[model samples]
Target: MSPCCNWMWGLSRRLVLSGRCQLSARHNVDVHRSFSSVPHPPRVCVVGSGPAGFYTAQHLLKHHTEVLVDIYEKLPVPFGLVRFGVAPDHPEVKNVINTFTQTAQSERCGFFGNVTIGNDVTVEELQAAYHAVVLSYGAEDKRELGIPGEDLPGVYAARDFVGWYNGLPYNRHLNPDLSSDTAIILGQGNVALDVARILLSPIELLKKTDITQCALDALIQSHVRRVLLIGRRGPLQVAFTIKELREMLHLPGTRPRLDPNDYQGLGDITKDLPRPRKRLTELLVKSALEEPTEKDATRWSVAEREWSLRFFRSPIEILPSKDGNKAAGVRLSVTRIEGTGDNSIAVPTGQVEDVSGGLVLSSIGYKSIPISQAVPFLPKQGVIPNSMGRVKESPGLYCSGWVKRGPVGVITTTMSDGFETAQAILEDMKSGNLNCSESRPGAAAIQKLLSLKQIQPISFSDWEKIDAVETARGLEIGKPREKILDPQEMLSVVSN
Candidate 1:
């Protein structure tokens, strides 16, 4: 890229980013990293490798004049959601990794992966060592339905299931019984639709994405059909991206059919909804009216057969199958929509009804778990609070990503949040607000944990090894990629 191009990229980067880093260009004459003076550059440590961390590092490098940055993550990989959360087949979306990688290449931009913040390091330690520490760790735990039998054998959490297939470390060990013939999904969110669509789609169709090999094979052997995704609100209030819904129409061999009556009730939530919805609403109507064209390929497609999601229903009870212990169906209490479901929300209130299924998945929401109490932690909301980006309770501490902004928004929003946090740190440093103390964590227990060589801290290099292997394996099968769902296996690959 030319100097002007680089300048444009850097300038555009600054407008949106805020959380971690200080900028110093690479020395054309191989200039050494400098420190140890009153004029020494700022040092930032970002916790988490998600989009927020990446951009936090980037904006600081490009815009700020003097600073060094480091990123820390519990996983051995970089690009948090790009690697784990995004649907793998969406390679275009995953392209964001290239930008993040470039930001991490700075000699000053360090990545400390596989290091648990509270365990391997502490919040206080970060405050003393680096000029600033930004937490960009995202939500991994799934919210419960707060209903009975939810923890039973036949039931599952959608976040856990998505992670299992997506190769997320927390829930990679999940082994779902794919032998069942029908399934139930609760929630009206986009994630809910994703779970239902993935379940109903054929394995061959799924192979195109970076779904785990184990998940794909299990899906190939899966006997499921007639997936019933239950929602507490009506279609207008459905919390899914229309583009994703449109993609569901094109899953090879599976049947997808939306109810004719469902469209009569779509609410104003979409009055001006952008992105996939603008196109999604059109495709939904066109496909229903038999008028789809090639232009629809950008975000949607007409289905050979399609799946359906029912609205205005909350799960009342999970009915086990005849043999017992296996999910058979869910009994629902219908709701009433007082007003339009989109901008102004309402739901249908009606009599109880029972829908049959062999599996049940709850997809209400995602939340970040508070790290063990060795550091500055939040009392409620399960996150460290901040003002735009600075930690409210701790000096020299900051946060970004879902943990910083709460569990919402797309990965793009994380990039913007990171930039914001980095900028705040820069302003703090300009005013000489950084604290560089040397208080060691005083615990033999902390010492033992650090000395355990068995635990490998994953870095960018380690993640590359895993990615290389998965990509190579995918070539053999003519798919996007196949993920390793075992933690031991992943660790071994990284360690080896």
Candidate 2:
């Protein structure tokens, strides 16, 4: 054949051998694979077992047929906030665990608990072992009040208090003194309301919940009969949801002690507010102005415990007891609103008030801490710098949940955030923005490293063993589940 004809024939043969041209030959499968370009299945590591991490993994597994996901948790157990941060009384909120359990049981997904991301394995190592690493560890620290006497004996961060009651191993020994008749909470968010309700709820009501045995015992001896929820803004600016507000109002043995003055004109303006805020404000106005129902009135008449809301009050200092050791009260500066809605600022009115209380809890907020210097974190915002969950300036690195956004919103908000991150990962994979040519060892390599470090990662079945033990122990009592409050104890259960 002529030179030109031979060149054309060679080009066509090359294309056919490269799998561009399908042939019905038996050897075509092997021939195509030898010359075909197919990337390895992407391996993703999520660095939290919380809702955010699980939801992200769930989305990845659902959308990608070949994606491998491994979840790493610092605790021996899964479900970070669901297991350790949610209020014991709100068991329904924790039902998300069922969905997470499904994800963990997926053949393509793996759960590695008792593996601290930054400690057991660095972010750099995880990136090396996986095609992508998602940092969803969430905000583990509380926002400080930055007021005097904050470190007083009787003062505590609401996160620690919640953790103490929820069986968090770190806060399990926080035996808060409950000898005082009144407790002061510095914040008007749902967490503040939860703390208030738990403090004032009849012991019989809490006994059935999964509250830590230690906390239950403390509550049994608690003399606290009054809870005061203080907010830095007016009633219209309160941050709590209507459901939480209603729960506090309808508390079995507690009565509302709201100031009528605070709700004086709220009824007139509530109609103009947003639906949620309107309902919350209307409830406040009705509870303050209108008389209670006959049954409620009778209940309140004999109720010995009460809760009150104090607005336009910013805690300036925690007053110390006579010994100057414990918090006896909170010194608040009366403030007036300067703007409207979320932009509204609490401006001091040069007026101060001292409300007496023996125990003080600050439920201001939770903030994320930088897990490693390798991750670019904005300390002021308490979040990793990210664009739609893609870590800025860091390829193959992403973040979700409170660490991607400041600690706010509920579980549904977190699910959306996790989905967004998963979408970003999928987009990167499709767009070739994420290099997936090289196969990753995923959890296999990491397990070797963990073994070398003497860190035995707890598997999902092992965690189930711990769960079964806790459940059996709780059945011995009337509670839902008596949590194993010690990491060592949890590991022991798994080991045995």
| TM-scores for every candidate against the unseen true structure | 0.81, 0.92
Each model's backbone clash number = 30, 0
Candidate whose lDDT is highest: 2
Give one digit per residue, the lDDT tens place, for model 2 in 1-496.
Answer: 2458435433432332233122213111111122213457788999999999999999999998888888999777999998888888999999999999999988778888777777668999998989999999999989998988899999999999999999987787788989999999999998999999999888898999999899989999999999999999999999999999989989998889988988887777877888988988888898899988999999999999999988999999999999897989999999999988778999999999999999999999999999899999999999999999999999999999999998899999999999999999999999999988798878877866865555566678878999999999999998889999866667667656
Candidates in order: C-alpha RMSD to true structure: 10.2, 13.8
The TM-score leader among the candidates is 2
For residues 286-367, could you state the per-residue lDDT of candidate 1 as single tens digits? 5554544565453344333246778778887878777776777888888876664256544446688998877788887888
Which residue pairs clash within candidate 2?
Answer: none
lDDT minimum window of 10 residues, candidate 1 = 18-27
Q: For model 1, what is the error of residue 359's alpha carbon versus the real structure, in angstroms, after optimal superposition?
A: 1.4
